[model samples]
Target: MLEILYYLQGHQSVYVGIVGAGIGALAAAIALRRARVAVTVLEAAGELLEIGAEIQMTPNVSVLLQRWDVADVIEDSLVQIEELNMRRKDGTLDGHTDIPVVEKALGRPWWLVHRAHLHEGIAVTAKRLGAAIHTNSRVVSLDHQAGGKVTFDLCRGADGLNSIVRSTLFPDVRPDAKTTNCAYRAVIPYERIRQDSIAKELIQKQTMEVWMGCNAYIITYPISAGELFNLVLSHHRPEKVYATQPDVPTEELRNEYKDFDPRIKCIVDMIHETSRWALLVTGPLKSWSSPQKNVVLMGDAAHSMVNHMAQGAATSMEDGAFLAKCIGAVVQGKLSLRKAITLYEVERMPKAFLKQQVSFLNGAIWRLAHGPKQQARDAAMAPDLEREYHVRSSNIYGDPQTVVDVYGYDVKVHAEEALEHFTNAEKDEYLGTGIVPGLEKYMGWFMKLPANQPHSKL
Candidate 1:
């Protein structure tokens, strides 16, 4: 492993063009720079601004960021949520889970953080690792061709939902994704909510609560070091909704959940400012990269899914990490860029598609109206208080193994396995062919080790 990294650093001039400065793109930049590859980040925005949104950082995401050494910056502003309480709209406690148990099992803490903090932390780390970030530099065109000798400047397409790179590759595929739901989001300062006797407990307890009900569900948690309360209310939108509308009136938002639990109703009423964001999802793309493999997609551009699983950001982070690892292999002359891109899609697309499907299903189950479906969902979610097992596995929340499968993915380990397998495959190919009669001249520089390269720390 150490030898491989030293070899990768020897080829540090492999230039990579990344099209976006979002979390996934920034992470990719950081990973590539740490591997000693030259990376440039291009952002469409003229200047980075606070997005003013909050996201959940599950154990999987937390662990990856930790491995990359940027976890401290994010951790400083995190609100550690210790439990998840699932309930029906009528305030019936359907089930609950100990977040600490899962955290202990996964070896990392789960947190809810403001998006601004996370973006800033990732940006700082990427710049520190020698990645050049250029804002207001949108990419409008890209072309690539593969031949006897593969040659093209590699470009990473993290340009987000309406990605032009994705459009260039799959022209028949539409950019506007289809969806049946939309969400209203807001953050209430603790100071404002703490004065209200009914809403004060929201600030007092460090727990994430999900209120599941007819045609809608609400999730709330403390963020910004418990300074504010973040709330997201998602509802089925039968009519076609626009991608996003920032000026939605709070009263209109509150009216959508007039029949929710009193607590939820109180939270809705307390929301003085909010915006509606469409939960659009593109089911699955036929391919995650171009035929040339020079341009590859990541994050929402690759797999945009509903947030019911809360794995949107986590999966995007994983994509960046895994893609970085593959690029590292390219840097070491162990894999061609085409092979690395193919391997990335082969391994990541399936998992991403599964998350998309499961998240859609979860949203369906959580937003059931008062009917047979709703009754069945509630009954299945009901807790078995008399069960002899000390550790609960089944409930309104997902099963324990499901939790592990979702939160326990280590991208670094998976990337290492892919590299090893690909390396072995190359050895087998070489053994089978003995030697390529005409390729020795081209392979000379690829096989030669640098004279004074040294292994670096992991």
Candidate 2:
């Protein structure tokens, strides 16, 4: 196996083993296959969640989805929102961005999908592409053997989130979820909400209507062939609690967002049940790879975030795609795994960490009162948030230039370049490596993508 690593460094023959089947694993399988690397995927869920909830796929995501031929698959089943309406705590229009038009301006479509459907779509595409998904199987512990092989402890922690894989890769960085508490999510039947003039108006409002209030926020959008509505509400409590087992009842759900507008009320009232879970954020780690094994952390296990900025799912998808490429390169003998992993961390850590922090702050601001900070946020996002009816629609489009730089990046570009750079060490494994890829030929893409150089600790 060690000889395989050396041969892999100079030749092209590598096989990849993945630990999870979420966005990261899916993307990894795609990328690895595209790069011609044999791959396998492992999952911890029984059946994929069929429950529906709205999800946003920014332009960065749109690019990859299109590239993978799954964009059409997802678009066929999701709603393309028209605009984004941001209102003050008192229900005054702060600013709005057009979603449908934004796609046109960016040359890509952004989609608002049912969460479960999106998962199914990805899993289906992955299966069709020959990627394996072993569910009802959990990875209990990781044994980093000497050869390029891994010993997984998959029998013990099989109940999903209490993942053995996560525990093994991040022993010292277990999630401290109590800080912010639960993020309340639910899908309301459209008929129940359409009865209200205001609610109906907002539903057909041709845009998203968001009401920011004291300690809570509610954003409404369409999903599930437009048969259902997607509602995401977040708030804070001194202690952590999940919505599925909330101390409060359905009646109390209305009181939580007490200050929201009437248009939002109809939808909230119609939410008979909510799928609530504790918001867990993992502490930063020194490495995403298990130095002692073949195990690697991906998705929420690596960078969990609140629902703010709607980047959690997107980020997870991006991780899967990038890992596939990285692992493919190593397995194919086109690059060294050690060198590839170094570039992976250098190029991925910064962006993922930023998204993590942004999700945290965005959620925090939403749960805050409608005073000074709200005023400041309204001023900052309004003008940049504005959208026209035809193009630059905030709902249907994204800042691709930004999303690509952050999420659309092809990690292989950097990995290869860093390896060839003269300053790159045979074993040093640092940014000093990026300099060797020859500035003229490959620097352009690196420069275009987000600058995810290593942190002092990463």
Q: How many residue pairs collide in each prediction?
A: 0, 32
| TM-score of predicted structure 1 | 0.85
Residue 421, model 2, lDDT: 60
Across residues 1-458, which tens digit of lDDT does each residue of candidate 1 receive?
00011122345347776767888778778888877677777777897654658988788788877877787767778888767877788767765677787788788878788989988999998888888888887667655453324234455666667777677777776544355688888888878887788867655668888888877889888888888888889986668565787888877888888877786678779888777887766548988776656667778777888788788878888888887888777877778766777778877887787667656666766776776555544444444222223222324243454565567767788778877766677533422211112222111221232322210100
Off by over 4 Å in 2: 1-11, 44-52, 146-161, 242-248, 381-429, 432-458
In the range 1-458, model 2's lDDT, one tens digit per residue, is 00011123344666555555555456656665676655566555685543436787776576777788776677667677777777754577865666655566557776777767777777777777776666666554544443335323111111124445556656666666746546677887778777767777766654666777777777777787787777877776777753245445777677787667766776788777665567776646576666632445556666676667778777766665655565565665555555565555665666677676656655555555655554444443444443322211121113333344443444445445544562344455454332122212211222232233211111
Q: For residue 55, what is the lDDT in candidate 1?
A: 83
Q: Which pairs clash inside model 1?
A: none
Q: Model 1 — which ten-residue stretch has the worst lDDT?
A: 1-10
Q: Name the regions of candidate 1 deviating beyond 4 angstroms.
A: 1-13, 50-52, 145-151, 175-177, 384-398, 426-458
